[model samples]
Target chain A: MNLLQKFCTRINLTKSSKGYNVSVIALLIILLLIGIFLSISIGSSKISLADIVSAIRLKDQGSNNYRIISFVRIPRTIAAVLVGCALAVSGAILQSVLNNSLASPNVIGVNSGAGLFFILTAAFFPVNIYLSTIAAFIGAILAVFLVYFIARKTGASRMAIVLSGVAVSSFIGAITDTVLTLKPDTMIARAAFLIGGFSGITMDKLSFAGVFILIALIASLVLSYDMNVLALGDESAKSLGLNISRIRFSSLILAAILAGSAISFAGHIGFVGLIVPHVARFIVGHDNRLVIPVSALMGSIFTLLCDLLARVLFAPYEIPVGIIMSFLGGPFFIYLLVKGRRGQLYD
Target chain B: MIKLEDISSGYNKITIIKDINISFNQGTITSIIGKNGCGKTTLLRTASNLLKPFSGKISVADKPITDYSDKELARKVSFLPQLRSVPNITVYNLVMHGRYPYLGFSRTPQKHDKEIVDRAIEEMNLASYVNKNIQELSGGQRQKVYIAMVLAQNSDIIFLDEPTTYLDINHQLEILQIVKRLKQMGKTIIMVLHDLSNALSYSDNICLMEKGQIAIYDSPEGVYKSGKIEEIFNVCSQQLAVADGTKQYVFYIE
Candidate 1:
């Protein structure tokens, strides 16, 4: 192992994490940067590194390369990285908070909640990004709280969380379908919104969602220690001076803000949140301090890779990145469920 | 000192410990002894502010415990629950978490905090295992690491629920001896123990509990003389003097 890798494994006696063990984190950052460059340069209208560099540097203003880089590739790449980061960090938070590996936003109705609300926004409001973002945030929080309430009422056991999550997801799915059926005109506009994609993303919406997500990610880092304590179960955590309910509620809100913003901007992307966090944990261990940042970078890297596959794999017959995620994430999600039930995955 | 007045504490809106009114004297080791499901753990939890009493007030150091910020209460009182989900973490990491209540928004323990954690690890005799993963240790060692965590919190009062449960007899006696050390340092320690013999031998006062109520609060000899031990445990007790001349209760269930 290199210095950074050795640094990654260095133990810090002051915090719950093993320290900022940078090997995996540094690797993920490098991987994400490579993915970003590829996502920009290897599209259908391929631009060379130098030309893309000039375009990014604004030296070739209004040129074909410039238009491709600025109008299409840059925004799409940004959306992919930010949306990936947002979803994965929040997913990591929810898993730690609920003390279950299966507690991702998509698995726990957050995506469906935000998706339904986004559809409602499209149907009721004019095609307004700001209104839709707000709607999605509210919807995600509502879904999370509903799942939490159901879990609490049903004994709040680890299994209850996932079970209630599925129930709420199905219920929200039914509502979203009904709204779509009742208003067919909104369907055309929200067609891309339903199945998540990074294509046609604008710099404006990306920046808006990006700010909130970056803030949430930082907050997750700050709250990571409490999250680690919470992983020890409620009684012990509470005995050690953690206000379990307060931390749970705050983390729920933070997770909602993250997933909701991603859904608002990228359109209900699934599996990135669930899969990326697990991947990061495999490398970084269960410490949320490492898990949160590593997962963010890993999420960005994975989704950017997926978006590249989605966009150019079929030569102009572009599929939404979310579909690709579901295809890849679906079986992995199943494996997680099966393995998690058998006590193979860390909770 | 911690005082509980008319405390009725439990889970999910139902009371498991009812109308508990007791004050744990300052700088002494007090053990609450009871049978299984007798609410000893619940009482400890309530007194330490882990469980909110359904009706009553709890005062620590002459102030309502509820009035103190969670961190403030934690700085004064530390509690170690009986059951905890052991995470895949190192002993140092687990014990360092005890410094969390003292940590700021950054949540990083400072140099002084590291010293405290190191002292705790040293005191627990876990210096060799501090770097090892928690799962690598035996059950008794894990319990000691947990106890070290509460000790590292460096609170004025510490509550341990069955601190000796998983230990061997020697280690159990060692922990009870550590309790004596804690008391000598002027720290009040409250513990819930199922072992009546250990409680009688180690504790300054034994609060005999039956069901959810305190049967009697007295020294080992006083509780034995109160005759509630026989009534509560269905055990006849005879006083026997140990080599140290301290009276010991020998009880046999009829």
Candidate 2:
């Protein structure tokens, strides 16, 4: 009896450590469903869950409320979800490739590069949204390339990469501010884009962004094992039969594409890319395969919730989704920083 | 069986190791020993295909190493480079990474693969700390975990570059014991060792190199008795006989 008790105790401990992962995933999914429903129902009209469902099924006879729900709100909700997932997955990949706790699209200057190009396109050319998006994508890629080329001496050093990214990002940001100051009308337009809101997203734009996001997401998932090996350092990874250069290049490219697309559509939504991945890592441990997918899901949920709060908090005068995310993500990030400094996550 | 035929290898525009011709026998432990800057590590890296040789060719079982696909080469040979910094990971998962070539795109380990990893962990006597993060382990324990990872590769030939740099005397011998056991299991083991005594005692063959050239490559007794240790290592030794009738070389300090 005693032997059986001891055996069961050992089994229980092992199961508990493993089971925490499933529970966290389950909780996040539940939160996501709740956030989705609340987001659809909590607009200016304040429709009930039944009306939202009926509207979704196209079985309701109503005023323009049904059209508002189907065409406008639905597209915005999906844009929020897609943008959030894209940004979060980009953050997770960048952090792993840089092997630093602070690496993200915002910190590394990729977002700033996209923003600068976005403003330039808006000012110089006719603001065809597609052209602006393409310009942003090119700018993001160029920025990452410049940072990588400058920082890499013999091989990629994490500190060098991060520091170089900061320097280049700040330089680009300074130019952007100078340009914005020169043209106040351009600044107003750019400011609306920069602060980040889902108020005006259309189904066509959402579908376009969705395709690119899906490609990036699939690419990230496929290369997740390589990402795990990369975290062990280049020499070790090479010895373990990984082509270090190929892995690094592919991960960086994927991160750039995802992040650039999100910035193009939503401007620079700051915290979703930076915080969502860290939260996922904390919950799921450091396995990239699990971290990538879970972070995507969590990011989508986080963005949806933030957008819902953005609509309801100041009712009639909507706040930017980015502001709400910062309000929520800022405190959470500080807690992670403290926890990391205390070495709580190292083990 | 591993053969390096007159290989010249180095970094870009700088030759580190030149004209190295040697063959490591199967089912034996071979040690490469040399003074600092003699290109011991460069030779190991070249032989393991980590560095591209500027000239000459290396073959495993008569097939050129460069001809093999990455996965194919991994299946035949495993390497453990000199330790720099330990990443944050657990011992169990670290060992499981060794089976990556076999698992391919599926990152999850199968039951049999887990059994092999568990056996490797047990062999290293790291069962108590199997669940603990690798960064928290002592230097010696961490070294064992790394060796266990290479062992979990289940390859016929293994190469290690300076496997005992940070270990004390006891852990050093413990690592040597593990290498000897690997030799007994009919695996071809080649390593660069800094400690002359450990190299002589544990290795079946010794290759002493100086100035990017082979000083001597022979049996331990042959190399020690050939009076070349004095030229290669700048030291003299006295032959000592133990009660077990095993001959040991004791180096005499000036």
TM-score of chain A of each: 0.85, 0.87
For residues A183-222, write the lDDT of model 2, one tens digit per residue.
6667866776678778888787667667888999999999
TM-score for each model: 0.90, 0.91
In candidate 2, what are the lDDT values of residues B107-157, reduced to their tens digit? Answer: 678888999999999888889988887877888999999999988888899
Best candidate (score: TM-score): 2
Span of 10 residues, lowest total lDDT, candidate 2 chain B: B81-90
Best candidate per DockQ, number? 1
Candidate 2 residue B126 Cα shift, in angstroms, is 3.1
Local lDDT at B148 for model 2: 92
What digit string (tens of lDDT, one per residue) describes model 1 on residues A22-48?
A: 545666778888898999999778788
lDDT for model 1 comes to 0.82
In terms of lDDT, model 2 sits at: 0.82
| CAPRI tier of model 1 | medium
